[model samples]
Target: MSLHSVFERLAARPWLAAFVFGAASALALPPVYALPVLLLTIPGLLTLLGRAKGWRQAAWIGAWFGFGHQLVGLYWVTHAILTDVAKWFWLVPLAAPGLALPMGLYSILPALVAWRLAPGWPRVLGFAGAWVLAELLRGWAFTGFPWNLMGTAWAFAPLPMQPAALIGAFGLSFFTILLAGLPLLGARRAFGTGGAILAVWMGYGAWRLQGLPPQGTGAQLVLVQGNVRQDLKWDPSHRAAIFQRYVALTSQGAAAAVAEHPEAPVLVVWPETASPFLLAQDPEAIRIATEALPPRGLLLAGTVRAEWGPDGRANALANSLVVLDADGQRHGLYDKSYLVPFGEFMPFGGLLPIRLAAGGMDFSAGPGPSTLPLPGGLPAPGPLICYEVIFPGEVVGAERPGWLLNVTNDAWFGNSAGPYQHLASARMRAVEEGLPMVRAAQTGISAVFDRAGREVARLGLGETGVLRAELPAAGPPTLFGRWGRWIPGGILILSLAVALLLGWRRPSQV
Candidate 1:
């Protein structure tokens, strides 16, 4: 049997083939990280597109492929719904497919465009270009959810990921799609070129790693991981316990730091919305928090800040990170800027059937990609609240911070791949910005990563512990930081140029 016949039979049932291929490719993401699967899946997808009867069929094929990819890659989204099974149980069946359908549309449109542009390697590059554009568009459209992007496949392994410093995640994603599809040509020429590209990809990564200086010392940080259960978190009864847990952890960190460096100021970090009380409105919460802070120590915690209207109602509420001195006075506040559409505030929210973040008024977005002035007014730390850490160039603004602080509430996703995937994005941001990051997550996976994207210290998922570490040093400005999306933009243009110049010929149906 020839390769043509094998794929012909496989492509005979396009949806099934695409589903399986896309699902297998998802293993390349965090937790499983079966990176080699990309080589198999991309070619299989190209085969389906090549065999499609029309552009519409090609679009559907790609949509099914993405559906399968996102269905498994984002299984954790179901975990959030499971948190409140009673009210959300009905959504359980619809959640996976519903979200997958729209997200998959991103892939479909791209494949449709690629299919129109002749065939052969042009089709291949077209596929790569379309797919990456889809990923980029998905992130931008609908307030952007760039979760489980193909480039994230390299997060666990540092070598292939090193180029992220120069090109950013989207640039890496471009190369990932292009190289993966090259093998579909099934010729010695194709194989040789693909192999050489892979070698260079790795060679560049290795060179970047070698160029890094020996890991140096970092700043002192106390990261609090309050293993708060999402189901119990919002309940009125559990609010007291949740508040106390954060306070206790903050105090514990202070005690440890006092013994080690009594005179130094230790930075304390808490995950997203760790505090349930309206922090600005409540005096009792402040009293308890103040009592926990050690002298010269600064506490940075996630809490809700309500700005009351003159009519004695909350004019606006922000999911904010508040900085407090030993006296618990509000030193600084960085409200989350990039709010999750459905999670934070729904899109066409009033018309929608679902509304997240407890049934209340929409939470106002803050002016973010902003810097936070430290307690004694230090160089300041860039604040990335919750999912905001996932964005690459957007993380840093005009005024660069000395370090990065990402506070998130991943407990909503439970003990799943979500936290790990989230961590991967944070690490990539650190590398791109050339700044150290302090990630404090509610319910574990709290960690510190250096500017080189190496883990300096960490606390595991589902465990309740305080991660004590020296906040790693920042490297010089990165290529991605200086240039931003221009690098990937250029790659997209070049790929299109080559595909056009090479000429498009119908790829072999087999």
Candidate 2:
């Protein structure tokens, strides 16, 4: 049989081809960035949708594809559950698929909409638009989990990433899907249009990066990577050793950073929950954490903050980033508002039988995003703890901060693509806001990116090291920065509108 016959045969199977093609599409995303593969997978998915018997079958095909896509992208989640396998052993296999099941539901709307459109341009546009709409919905629905967005596929480097400065990541997703599906009907003009648009897209990005490299902000950063294992991070017996490891690394990192840039103000950053003890509740923990700070230097350490009740018990807990000075005086505190579902708090708490988070109590969330001033004349930064950096257009607040700080614990998914994907999201945010982003991840992939999404320095996964780099000066506000989600939302709306109009004018026979 020819290639067409084989593909048709595979598409005939309700579950096989759609799921395989969907899983294949994830290869276009970060760490694996096989972008050209989208030409085959997306067109193949449209073909599968075209072969569906009806709207319900189309939805099911889309859902199966989504399930495969998300299953591969989220397979690393199983590593987290395996950390305490004794309690979650049975859940190890279910973790990725469990999350993929619900995420798969988001693809249904796009499939249904595409089912209504003509097989040529209308189906392509409608599918891409409705797909982004579903992505947007999942981004905010149920407190949002916007991972592996189609736009992030361009995050392999700084050049292709510049468009994010204009239209943001979601906007990039719109065009990415639109272009990738242009040849679904084997139209000659569609092939040429796709090529020309891609050329323009890349050429524009190149032009945007042509200027001089960004200048330094006269501030230096020391990102401390403890390389702590997830299982040992919270152990009572290993608590003292873990705290000591961070203290030692901090002192060494601070000393070296000050020596490199003596005049510049040094800022030491510890990854999320690096301190084994509760720094907010323990005075001695604060003292030890600040001991390594250079004169006029500051520290941003992630730790659990507690609200102690009068009954000698904690009423609430917050995953927080606490800033401190060398004198053991606290400077500022930013509590994490975007808590991870199940990892930090169980969704519909009482309805669930078991708790996925470490403790019995779910973490209390902080007020939404805020920009805070820093001490020592350093630039003020917006803090995004853990997975909060994954959410595009939601990283900043009313007042744009000078820089972005992300503290996370990627050790939960050791040696996996999860940490690298997380780093890519941080890079996209830097480009979108035209601001530098400093990310400190426990165990690996701690990196610094300039305003234009250029990588400045990095420490690979499972490494114990401190990266010292001067903070790059923030660039001018970007189009996306000024308008936020409006640009992408507008693109999504216009694409869908045109698709619907075309479908009305020329009805499709599926």
Candidate 3:
């Protein structure tokens, strides 16, 4: 059967078929990055949107397509919920659709507007522009959960991600959707446009990575990955063993790294909350953790930092990256800024008091872009605790850090694609900022990436190990960094407005 006939048949009940198209888009993401699949599905979606009779119908079609896409792409959230199924089992089914419903709405507006005003080349441009607009909106609106932008499809191919350096992920998302929509214009135009874009993208990446200093930037880091399970992670009984395991790993890793690169300074790292108890408050914990560090070595770790009220009671708690000198005395602290909505702070869930942080308590967002001063007069590494690394321009403040030190707790996501997806986002941040990234994760996928987003070393899911490697030096400040994230997004928004204006002038023939 002809492709058009099949699409017409499926479009009769757009909801279910659009979902299939949506699910297929998930293949374009990491772990199963079959980006070519977007060609078949996106074109089908555009054609279906093309045939819609009214704005409402187009919105329904778009919404269903988005629903399917988000549902499948964010299925990993259910895994996080299932980890504590006793308390959250009922939430598993609701989790996927609950999140997908709002995210899918992002697709609805763009689809409807494009259908009304766009057809042919204008239609294609409108669709791409619309998608980027949606992604941009979803990124900022209501605490922002910009999980799977269309640009992420190119992450598996390192060459394509370099464009992110020039135009942030939103711009790449614009081009990605634009290319997907090109298939609607027959094989010749599709292949020609797609090939041209691919060529330019590859050339740009080559120019960027070409002649990068092949040697390390004198910063050697050891990332400690303690495979602590989500359930046992917070149990008071398990805290001692957990701290012991990370301490042992860091001790071993620092020794081996110093031996291998005797001249280079080695820094030991622990994943997010690798120390459950407050190391700063507990003198014994500090002594044990410090015992593992070399004489001049430093320990950069993730843990909770509480601000005590003047009355002697604790007030605000921050998810922080703590820097410790050889004596275990704290050097500096970088608190996580972009806190996860429900995970860190309850969104709309009423606030509660903080007496003992040991209880189940939400963390208040920290002032981000806070760079920690290191031992050497060396360039400081900015710590991005957890999901903060996912944001582009926000990673670097006025004082650009030497490298990105991302410490996260992915144990909540388990051994699923969640960790892989998180790792992918971390790599993109490296490319976007032109800074190398040293990521330490609890329960797996800890890795070190260069400015080009190349994986220098990695520890996979559920593995207990320390990744020892010299940190790749930061490249020159990226265009995305210099111009800021909005420039590329603004460019695409302008293109979208122009496409919509053009579409308004001429009616599309179905």
**Predicted structure with the largest lDDT when compared to the true one:** 2
TM-score of each: 0.94, 0.97, 0.95
lDDT of each: 0.81, 0.88, 0.81
Error of 1 at 506 (Å): 9.9
Residue by residue across 239-274, what tens digits does model 3's lDDT show?
889999989998999999888877777788888878
Which residue segments of model 1 deviate by more than 4 Å?
1-7, 117-119, 214-218, 505-510
TM-score of 3: 0.95
| Structure candidate 2, residue pairs in collision | none
lDDT of 3: 0.81
Candidate 3 — which residues are off by over 4 angstroms? 1-5, 310-313, 349-358, 505-510
Local accuracy of candidate 2 as per-residue lDDT tens digits, 130-175: 8889989989999999999999999999998999999999988988
Report the Cα lDDT for residue 343, model 1.
75
TM-score of 1: 0.94
2 or 3: which has the higher lDDT?
Answer: 2
